[model samples]
Target chain A: MSESRLNVLKTYKLFVGGKFPRSESGRVYEVSDAKGNWLANAPLASRKDARDAVVAARKAFGGWSGATAYNRGQVLYRVAEMLEGRREQFVREVADAEGLSKSKAAAVVDSGIDRWVWYAGWTDKIGQIAGAANPVAGPYFNLSTTEPTGVVTVLAPQDSSFLGLISVLAPVIATGNTAVVVTSYEAPLPALSLAEVLATSDVPGGVVNVLSGKASEIAPHLAAHADVNAIDLTGADADLARELEVAAAENLKRVLRPAVTAEDWTAEPGTERLLAFLETKTVWHPIGV
Target chain B: MPQSIPQTVPAHGPDAAARLASMADVTASDAALRRFLHGLPGVDAVGLEGRAAMLGTRSIKTTAKAYAIDLAISMIDLTTLEGADTPGKVRALCAKGVSPDPTDRTTPRVAAICVYPDMVETAKAALAGSGVHVASVATAFPAGRAALPVKLADTADAVAAGADEIDMVIDRGAFLAGRYLSVFEEIKAVKQACAREDGSAAHLKVIFENGELSTYDNIRRASWLAMLAGADFIKTSTGKVAVNATPPGTLLMLEAVRDFRAATGVQVGVKPAGGIRTSKDAIKYLVMVNETLGEEWLTPEWFRFGASSLLNDLLMQRQKLSTGRYSGPDYVTVD
Candidate 1:
């Protein structure tokens, strides 16, 4: 009876604008496990795919950014809930992707879910912490509030596929900005799987677009894209990051430089990533007007 | 210019006029118009759509894409027909029409600026000396529910206001009710209304509002009917309707112009207005035109995109081509 059964395989596709699509270039690269066993073929997105993702992210920007902070918080929490239900699948994928043992993979998956929940809580609170009623030296009530900085292009961390990817992605969107995330090159399976979670979660389509491909190939286009408002270079290496920073300057895009040291995925996170994609808009109202 | 002279006769050699006049028997009466319109070859919906979709798949890239983008830019009838349109808005739209991308001087200007009858003077004044024509929609515009006299007065008012082109809407209710001669007579009447005192008439673009016509067969019949009634251009829709322009609908119109030219040698223009927003879609239409009507109809004179937002997408794509980076809306004007 066991001999007659065949194992079902999954097709990994790029998630752009809330739908799963193969690369417009129709190219896919082979992905393997830690021991070099072939796992699946992930779409090797082209510059065109990166462009399409920017368009999708821009289209989703108005609705997603206009959503109530409380509603956004609920959506992020819903992503965590979806991840909790798919814990076993993530554990398996993370185990295969990072060459970790099942127990360690399960722990990492749990951490990723916790990360989503953590950011979900920050959605409504980040503004209160970051914004203020400015004290001006005049008879005026000046208010400063934070706004989402439009479409953001995110490069997911390479080594820590599941936890690190979620760490960078959750905050960009949780704060209201839409994202075009380029998943880690070698271990894209976990990120592609996470896209399914985001889709099923209440996250609106285009709010977080996921493309699985070489970061070096896709990041440059996105970094230089005039439409992309900001870019997180966390997944890029030294040389690529330098080039991308220069490209991002053409349109004066907000650039999040990669850390000099290897990031500790398990460490308690800070509010830096959440603040990276937000802008402060100051309004001054005359006292008696 | 007399009403007795059928407007179907092109303003050209006597040979061309004689040829078109000979074919005028088709519109001699209601029965003749009905038989002629019905007698045209029936559209193979599957085959037409298949060909259009097949042509749409042609990959235009790099230098070719650059050329197509520029060509498409020149073909746009930058339109603003909102009820709340102000003089300021029309002037801004006129400035945009003159220099689509103010940042890039090389960007070709659009063919015309389309507006309503009341705003014709503002648009004409704003577009003066820019080489961009002011096109005013007449004949009660999007609905076309008014009487023939009111429609003609509307057309005459726009013409007096210095409009270079008059985009008139056909009586769709009459057409749908199989009153082909009435629609044909109305179009002929509007064509006469387009005449100016200087012996020059504004080019007449007849809108079918193909969405309301209900069938591909009707669209084909409408296309022929407009072309035969002396429409300088046959436009797809008014852009107010829910379904303005679709690929297959545009393809059918293109085929109509192509066949009309072959049959009568009066190469009428085709304008697929509304709902086309991206450079990729614009390039697809260019590819369709190149394949269907050949290179001759590729210019702004023969084909046009009746759009407002399409210009920005074309400009963005042009910037992407020049800089090798994707351009965004922030870089373009908000309009």
Candidate 2:
């Protein structure tokens, strides 16, 4: 009998500039399962890669933000639809990355899809809830509205690789912000695969760039990037977060602090993530022509 | 392969212009222009883009960044080329060009103010003593499809209206159909049209409309053709096409100027007009210019950005660098 061929494992690459490219640094680190079994090699993104991601995100910000809320909502919904179609692949990847049972992994994947849908629905409505007109004393009309805070750098939650990543990322883009996400260090395969879904979806290129590397190695460069408008520190540890916060202060970046503890990935998430990357603009126009 | 750069070529001399006009044997006939251009090297798109991407990573920092920012601001050809551009709008743009940041008079003025032929007089009047030149786009502009006489008239009108520089677009149809000499002669005619009776001429910028040509080889050939026809500068686009100036496209043009200088002893400026809208993007172009052609091409006379929104972003970033705080669009005027 002929010998059977070995399965071809895929190499997880970084997503930037709307294309999938291996890290410019040409370095890849071994990614394994929770049980220490080999999975694949993930691209070890460098500071240059972080800078490139910021460029991509900044380029994408104009089109994504200028897109009507309805259009953005449909694009987000398209992401959820694409994710639903690739359900089994994510289930397998998540199960391997986190050492969860197949059923639990499937549940995590389902929650991620549902979380996209939830954010997708909020795209058109977030503005109405957050924007308002005020009664000013002078002969002037004053109104306030929320605008995307340009490019946002997101450090995905290190533990709940899939669900937590979508939780932090979906809200940023749904509200018209483009993100450069640093995927989980230990469990990066799922986040990498999610990048595939994002590409297939209607989401514009550079709207959500995924980098698979150590957050410690990549997050600091992004935190200090003058082009990056804000950063979410959900995936960082105390010391790294503290360092990033200090660097973020250099540009007055709107930082979302890390949660106190790793929360249940399936638990309810509020509007705080959506509000995290939004900048409010109040306009005053004269009442008379 | 692109030609290797030589160590030094004497600066383009008076006779070099006569020699440059003589270097092309095929100038008199259509087939010769075709043969010469077709014989030129082909560009590997992937390789060209890779070089541009690599050069874009130079980390221009702190003091270097501040210097680059100011240098970039001074290099801007503050442009407003819309069908809806009125006298008031042109005047406003001219004012902004003279004093980029009203709050800070110390800010360096822009290199020039770019406008249409009809608005050239207004821009020139507004920028009379400011040392800011008025650059007018002619030669049927966005689309170089009009008859030669009309295109020449457009050039003469702008030059007569006190325009110091005339930006013209080449006919892409003639270029794409491989009629290289026709394209060359048209640029020559426009160059002649830019000359005034007083023996001085407005500097000529030839726009290749790189997006329309759709190939790097064509852009390279067009660049040489324009240079041989006595173009003072070669621009990448008119800012009207869907794919205006890009890093790779501009890099290719920069390489052409570098090589043209090596071959003919003539130096031509490069303007990557359109879609470059931030302080960072401007710096990257500067990086490309610095690394590809070196610091000799870093001055406003040698390099220019044909953009409008780019000025505000540069000003805002300049404010941030100076005051240590980010300035919003509110702080800058909305010209």
Per-residue alpha-carbon lDDT of candidate 1 for residues B228-325, written as tens digits (9 for 90 to 100): 88888899999999999888999999999888877886778899999999998999999999988899889988899999999998998899889888
Which candidate tops lDDT? Answer: 1
lDDT of 2 at B124: 87
Chain B TM-scores per candidate, in order, are 0.95, 0.95
Go through the candidates in order and give each one's C-alpha lDDT: 0.92, 0.89
Chain B only: TM-score of model 1: 0.95
Looking at model 1, the pairs that clash are none
How far off is residue B6 in model 2, in Å? 21
- Which regions of candidate 2 deviate over 4 angstroms? A1-3, A58-87, A102-150, A174-176, A275-289, B1-78, B88-110, B142-153, B168-199, B206-335
Model 2, range A26-87, lDDT digits (tens) per residue?
Answer: 99999999999988999999987887788788889899999999999999998899999999
lDDT of 2 by residue, B86-137 (tens): 9999999999999999888879999999999999989989998999999999
